[model samples]
Each structure stands twice: as C-alpha cells, then as structure tokens.
Target: MRRRQFLAGGTTLLATAVAGCGHPSVVLDMDEATAADIANQVSISPEPGSAEYTVVSAAIENASSTRRGRSELFDRTDTVRIGDSFYEVSETPLESSEVTVYEVRLDFDPADSTAEIGEIAYEELPAADRQRLDPIISDDNPPSGDGYDVGIGYGTTQEVGDGSVFVPEQQYDIIVHNGDRYRVGVSTRTTTETEYRYEATAVTSGVDSFADRVRDQYLFTLTGLSEAEREVVEEAIDGGYFQDDEAFRSVTNRIREHEGLDVTDSYGTWLLEYEQVEYLTYVEW
Candidate 1:
C-alpha cells in the first residue's frame, strides 16, 4: 500500500513544452525510449487531436499522477504503462473490501488474506448467567422457536424527563450443535414505563461452510492466479457450496482425496491448505 515516489528526470523537454498551459501536464520525467515504448504499446496515432490520441493521452496523464506501479495500475487500465510492467487487469473485482479503495492497497499479498467472519471460538458465560439461561433450554425446540429471536440488535439512549433512559441492547446466545457453534440474538427495547419490545430473531453468525472458508483464505491467491486455476476455486464458491451441505461435503471430500497433488503452483498450495482446514458448524439452540 506504500505510495511510489515519483522519479525526477528524462521528460524535461515534455515538461518544458507543457509548462504554464493551465492544467497539470500529462508529461512526467520519462525518458525518450520509455515514452516511445509506451506510445507504441498504446498505438497512439500521430494526429495529436484524434480520438485515440486524446484517450491514450488522458489515461497516461491520470496514471502518472494516480498510479505509478504495476500493482497500482493492476485493475485500472492496460493501455497506460506506469513503469516496466503491463498488467492483465481482471474484470471481476477481488473479493475484498481492502481492494475496493484505490488509496489503500497498491499491492496484494496472498498470505495476508483473512476471513470476513474471522476467528470464532466458544467463550464461557458466567456461572450465574449460565444457571439462569439453563431454565430456557429446550432441546426439543431450537433457538428459532416462535417466542425466541436471533441476530444483531441496534438501539439508542434517549432523555426521559431529566434523566436518560438506556434501552435494552441486543443479547447473544451461543449454541453448540453438530460440532459447530452459532450465535443467536434478539433486540430488546423499553416501549413505555412498563412495556418492552423485542424483534429481529435470526441466526447471525457461525454459518460458514467449506467453500466460504476457502474463499476467505485464498482470495488474494485466486486473484493472482490464471483463469484456469482461479476457475476451479471460483466454481466451488459460486456453485452453492456455502448453502448446500451436500455440496460442501463433496468439496471437502474432493480436497481430502487430492492430498497428494503437487504444491509447486499457487493453486496447488492453496488446495493443500484447503484440505487441512477444519470446518465447523453451529446452529441456534
């Protein structure tokens, strides 16, 4: 994400020609050979005011100020050469919020890929709280029962008379089921002096499947890979592996059976890691 420092030299003639022309010149300190190489690559016409010339010229001008490296210009444009590299820009955006913002990431590292949900592990509630919640336990009825609710909640504090009244916030109930954990919660609020309101019942967390895990772990790797290699992983994701348990199991089995595959390539190494991941599941209690 480091900003590349602009180099100073070589385009003195270009700079001189565009000086005092109002807007910032498209010209940078590029040498004649480099400039000529870029011009040829873009196939800019000799006619200065032609459509092709204007578009290429503008793209170069934009790139010189905004993108100065291969990574910076990766998804931006292929016509404008920033440095020595001409990138194969992907039409599909990388599966990351970090990559969306232009000012943040200039380079991507596969090892830095992270899950959106991050780490989920069980945490013990206080003994007293556990004791109180034990009474609500009904193994026959899941947390999705008619009266119970699940999911995140939002509320605000408001002034009542001379004092501020704090509304009941959302609460989470962790349920361990089928070797996985889930978070269920409901929003609570005071309606009046004695009345209360609760809404938004849904399972909010711990729902990732095998394909989801792979997507999170290898997003950057997939982005850097060739179309063929990337397609394998993409198919597993977009093919409903996260929603269908049967499909997820099939993928898991495939990864497990392919344990001996070569790890010489990025995709191969990613598959190896995918095979080793421990998938877990959780549901509302």
Candidate 2:
C-alpha cells in the first residue's frame, strides 16, 4: 500500500515489549499531548543521512513486519540514530485484532532532548521489504470470518459480519519516561472502521445560533429541554461561557444542580440517548 494510505489506518493501543536481557519490558502508554508533540516534529520528507531518514533506514533494515506474534525466540534488536543519540529499536507485531498491529519501540538511553521520530515514504522502501509488508498493510487482504471484539467509538457504530476490518495507518512516536532511558515509539490501532456510521439523532448545523453551535461542536442535543433550562443554556452560550473550560464546567454544574440536565462540559458523549444511523450527515466544520 502507499504511505498515506498506510497512515490513514493508524489507531491507538496500549501494549508492552521486552527490551532484552537486564532491561525491563515497558508499557506503551501514549497520551494526546505526547502524541501531538512527536507528530509536530515528524519529517514526511527528509534529506539522506539526516536523523529522520537514518531512523527510517534503520527501521527498514530491522524490518520484522512479516512476524506473526510476540515470541521470545523470534525477538530481534537493532540500533537507530535520533540526532546525536542512538536508541535500541525493536518491532513487535501483535495479533490481537483481525489485522496485525505492529509496535515499533525505541529506547532512549539518558533521554536526549534532540531525539525525534517520523514517517518514511513507502516508495523509499526496498522492493523486497515492501513485498513482505503488503499483506500487513494492504486493504486487498481481507480478514477471515473471525470477528473483532473491540467496541465502537462515539458518533459511529460498526456493522455485523466480515464487512468491518481494522486498517493500520501512519506510525507516530510517543515519549514515555522510564528512569534514565526514556521509552519512545509508535504502535498501530484501528483509526478507520469501514462499517461505522453515525447515530440517527445526530444532527449537523452551521454557524447559525448559539444552540446550533453547541450541537455542532459538542454533540449536545437540545431537543428535550425545558423552557427554563433552554433559556439558561442559551444565555450561557450567548455570554461565551462555553468557550472557556472553567466557565463551561461551572455552567454545566449549575444546570445539573438546579435544572437536573444530563450534560457534560466536554465533547463526544451524547447528553441524551439517540438512535443509530447507517451514515453521517456531511457538515462543514
């Protein structure tokens, strides 16, 4: 598959890998802030012999994408450069889903600030290595009748049967502090679900009114609101209290206290239950 196509399938997952004898197996716990930081520094295109290009070359040289699952007997270790610092890198492919989830980890000895990571173009990979990775990254390779056990995320639902499959996308680095050596790496998860669709009651709106803005941005439904409660929400939105986190929390707390409204200050979760739909309404955000 192409590089962009490969990256579009990337998702998040928590996993751990052994760093060999004497070193501890570290958990791959990545938070949003850390992920974003690494992503910002990634070079989609890098000059030859540069740190970014060197790491990509190292990853390809140590490619274990064909490996099926975690095995003590099959583990391989190699070193890659990130600026002036060199890290021990390992590839662990987890067969936890319908698709193989590959985890690439780098152990930063003493944790250098200049150490970074990014993606490499698929065309840049060796012809032989690309062939080996085809089945792992290709959409043509469909899953067997065996189903996935993972649940769907908010705003969408997955269809039954073999129509749904998890596609691995672009790998990103996540830095985790582990004493002297910081464990930094990238792992794949389900980013795009082919069978997922929007919930039916989910509505889309442009920049029309404060209520419309709340529905569009927060996914908050104002359908079953009392007249008094509706007025309070409108007032809060109009006063721009929703723009600030603290103010938004205070407003939501007050509404919950007096109005008894089932609401939250954050986005994603539906305040009121809604039916499922086969598709989402396309809206200009």
Candidate 3:
C-alpha cells in the first residue's frame, strides 16, 4: 500500500494497493471535502479534545483504508456506497487500555468495495485482546442480551457544558471472569438525598449462545499497575468484589488510597474518583 503526497492544496489523497502478477493496483482518489464528509459520516473527527483514542483510530483507518479496503468494514450491513464518487465511510470502535477507539475508513471506488484483503482480517488479534476496543457509540435504550440480564442507569453527576447544549451521562460496569461467568453493575447520580443510585445483575452466557460466542472477546488492561497493585486488583476479583456493590466500592477506595504510585497514566484521572466510573456504557449518552 502506498499514497502519493498531497498536492499544494492538501485536498488530494491518492492511494494505491500493490498487487501481484495478474491484478493491477487499485487507486482511490479523494479530495479533502470527500475525506472530511466521510469522517463526519463515521463520527470520527480529528478535531481536538475528542478523546485521543478516537483520533488515533480515525487517523490510522483513514490512512490505511485509503490504500486498500479493510474487509472487516464489510461485516457491517449499514455500510453504503453513495454519491457520484461512490464514496464509502465507516467507523469501527475498538478498546485499548482505558479509552475507546473509532476507526474510520473511506473508499472512493465501487469496484474496490468487494475486494478481499486477507491481511486486514479481524482474526489478527486474539479474542481477549479484541474485546478491549469499543465503538463509543451510544443509544438511549440499553442493548439487550438474550439470556443475560441487561442493567442500565444514568449518573446523577452533571458535567458542565456550554449554555446551549447538555447531554445526560450514564455508566455500566461489567466483569467477565471467564467463559461462563460475568457480572454487571449500573450507576447514576440522583437529586435525592442519597445523591446516587445503582443496580446489578449476574449473568451466564450459555454455551454456544451469543454471549458465549463473544465470551473470549473480553479485554483487560493491567498495563500501569505495579506488581503489588496488580495483586490487589487480582485479589479483589478473586474475592468476588465486582459481584457485590459494597465489596466493589471497598476495593475501589483501597486502590485510590495508594498514594505511593500514580495510577493516573493508565487508568485516567476518572478512576481517582471511583464514583465516576461505569462499566458497559460511556460517560455521556
């Protein structure tokens, strides 16, 4: 895969996929407007302060898919080819460490859409590692799980926003112990005296069911924890903290009290205030 340097205006993006013997390289020609429009459709803007992970995913996908179609993009049925250029744009979310990633792909030619590129297959990563990525896509109603109960809630806490716009936020926490076990907890801030609310449910993804098929996809990142800190987290899990609200809160407080090491880099400052973390959903709806 290769791309020619953008011309003087910075609008032209010409990408070519190198092929062997019988097939000629496929080239995609796109200008800045085309690229930007595709970016918008996919919900990944390179604009500042829009989560660093999203920017990285968008940038990588934009550049690579410009060179060749990522077959994984086809797994989505909503993907469409439209406009005179037959442009195609897509946003695929992934999880890395503490943040969510939105991969954006743009294709210019209709013929290029059906091309199969084996190297870009999602199978490249192990199931567990793959689960770490998320789309950061949100919806008003919680998603349904066949046999597993779905728990949902909104945070009572409000993040200040510009006068004209305000978006309510929600959080969910899910822990997958292994193939057959998982627990979920939901929380939200409230105006009442208690000021917060929570709900939890335990679920079993029956064998060969939807949950079971995705069981191995769960991803966890322990990158920033010290050996002792990691042990503490492991102990919490072993003790079933995630399944109990009180126990989970206790372990959270313990982790926060560790002033000897700064856990902010990997976990984000949000973890410092455990009240703000949610499991399955993003902070804002």
Candidate 4:
C-alpha cells in the first residue's frame, strides 16, 4: 500500500501530464498538515475545477499496494474536469497474468474536485478491439437480455493483524461465476477469514447477478485451462439476476477490460505464502 512514489512534486501542467504518461494523477495542493497525514494514506492530487462533478454511484476506496500493486495507479477517475468539455485524466491500468488492479477513485474536496472524464469511448478504438472494450463501459445493464441469473456466496473466514510479518488485513475474495460461461473475479480484499458474510445487500445481490451475465452473454474470457480445472469450472456456473447488473458489471468489467504488458525491472520479496485462492462478487455500498 505504501509502495508508490507520490509524485515527488508538481511542475507545469504539460510536463506533469506527459510525465503521467496519460494516466490519472493527483496534483497535490495539500498543505503541510494534509500532506503528512496522506503520507501514510493513498490519494489522488487534482489540478483544479469541478463544479459539475458527479458523485460516485459507489464508494471509491483508495487503491493500495495490496489492492493494485502500485502499477495500476494511472487509469482511475483521478480527475474529471468538466469546464468547456468533459475531460478525464486517467491512467491505463497495467495488465498482467496477475490481477490487474483498477486504481480506486480518490475522494475530492470542493477545492480538490475536477471534472470526471466519462467512460473511455469504445468507438475510439479499432472495430474489433472496440468490440472487446465495448461491454466495459456500456450504460446498458444485464437485464436487457445481455444479463441473466447466476449464484453468489461470501463469508469472512478470518482476519490477520499481529506484529508477525505474516499477518494480513481483512481477508476475503468475491467470486461470480456464470452458468457454464466465463467467471468473473469480483474481489480480493484484506480479510481475516477465507470467507466473509458482508451484511450489505448489494454484495449478496451483486454476487448472484454477476453469475448470470457470464452464463447468458458472450463476455471476454481467458482460455487455456487444464482439463481438470475445466471440469471443476463446469459446475460453478449459474444464470443472472436483474437488479444487480450494474454492480455485477463493475466487478467483472475491471478485469474483463484489462489486457496488456506488466513487468518489473527490479524486485524484492519477503516471506510469501500461496494461500488457497477464493473468489466472490461484492458491491461496496
């Protein structure tokens, strides 16, 4: 979580944008008090201006090293400026065999707000690739025949917080598997238990809805599973639900929308354990 190098400091907007490489970045106007507090916190620094900024439909968590591994900081809704035209300053999340983390939407103060760039217009890409990115930003939810019914499950099995280096934060992952189609990785957040029952109805509902789309529609999928794994997967699929499509789509789209190169020139490691990986679908209220 503490891995990213907060922009060392800001410069001219042009230089800053170029340095950002088109990824969304925070331009800090934080005074000493705020900067120091944010030193341990992850956040976005904005350029300015956001009179018509829209509140998030969902709660936006700050993407942390554990959540996104610091590499995907760019593609978030860092700052959406709505002055003359709608403009969003977002970074493209890095794609890899590992999880591609979507940067969390940082909260904006009145002074910190910016016009949120709307969805990446899918029409902007080639016809074929456009097909791939299309579903990611569609205003259409599942009930329009593109979405159906599915199954869901969540329960916190543990929590780890100790002086030990092995300790982890809350431990949980939400899995949404469509009936005989592509399954979506809904979440992998800090949890003590292998499973957690989130009290929120969105989670319970989102899980079931996420399952249906995979079964009913032709969403993007990663193939090449072993025969044994494939056999196990066959049983996990389900139909969809109408009410939770938007939230279900969100969990699925972030990963579905990601595909690119991800590598590290340097490296470091501590004690690492491959725990049994579990997946669940959740909608943060």
Q: Pick the candidate with the highest TM-score.
A: 2
Tens-place lDDT digits, model 2, residues 1-285: 111111211211000111122222211111111222222111122457754354445455554223222232112213232333333344343333243333333333333434345333444444533444344334333232222212222111221222212113323232222222223343454432221111111122211232333334333223455555455444432321113334334434432333211122321112221122111111000
For this target, which candidate reaches the highest lDDT against the unseen true structure? 2
Give the alpha carbon lDDT tens digit for every residue of 154-248 in model 1: 22232211121111322223344344444433334333221111111111122233234333543221123445434444443332112234433
Candidates by TM-score, descending order = 2, 1, 4, 3
Please report the TM-score between candidate 3 and the true structure.
0.14
Off by over 4 Å in 3: 1-241, 264-285
Kindly list the per-residue Cα lDDT of model 4 for residues 227-283, writing each as its tens digit. 543332332222111222343334333433332111112111111011222122111
Please give the lDDT score at residue 74 for candidate 4: 30
Mark the 10 consecutive residues where model 4 has the least summed lDDT.
266-275
Where in model 4 is the C-alpha error above 4 Å? 1-76, 79-86, 90-221, 239-285
**What's each prediction's clash count?**
6, 5, 15, 50
The lDDT ranking, best first, is 2, 1, 3, 4
lDDT of 4 at 40: 14
lDDT of 4: 0.24
What's the lDDT for residue 227 in model 3?
A: 55
Q: What TM-score fits each model? A: 0.16, 0.19, 0.14, 0.14
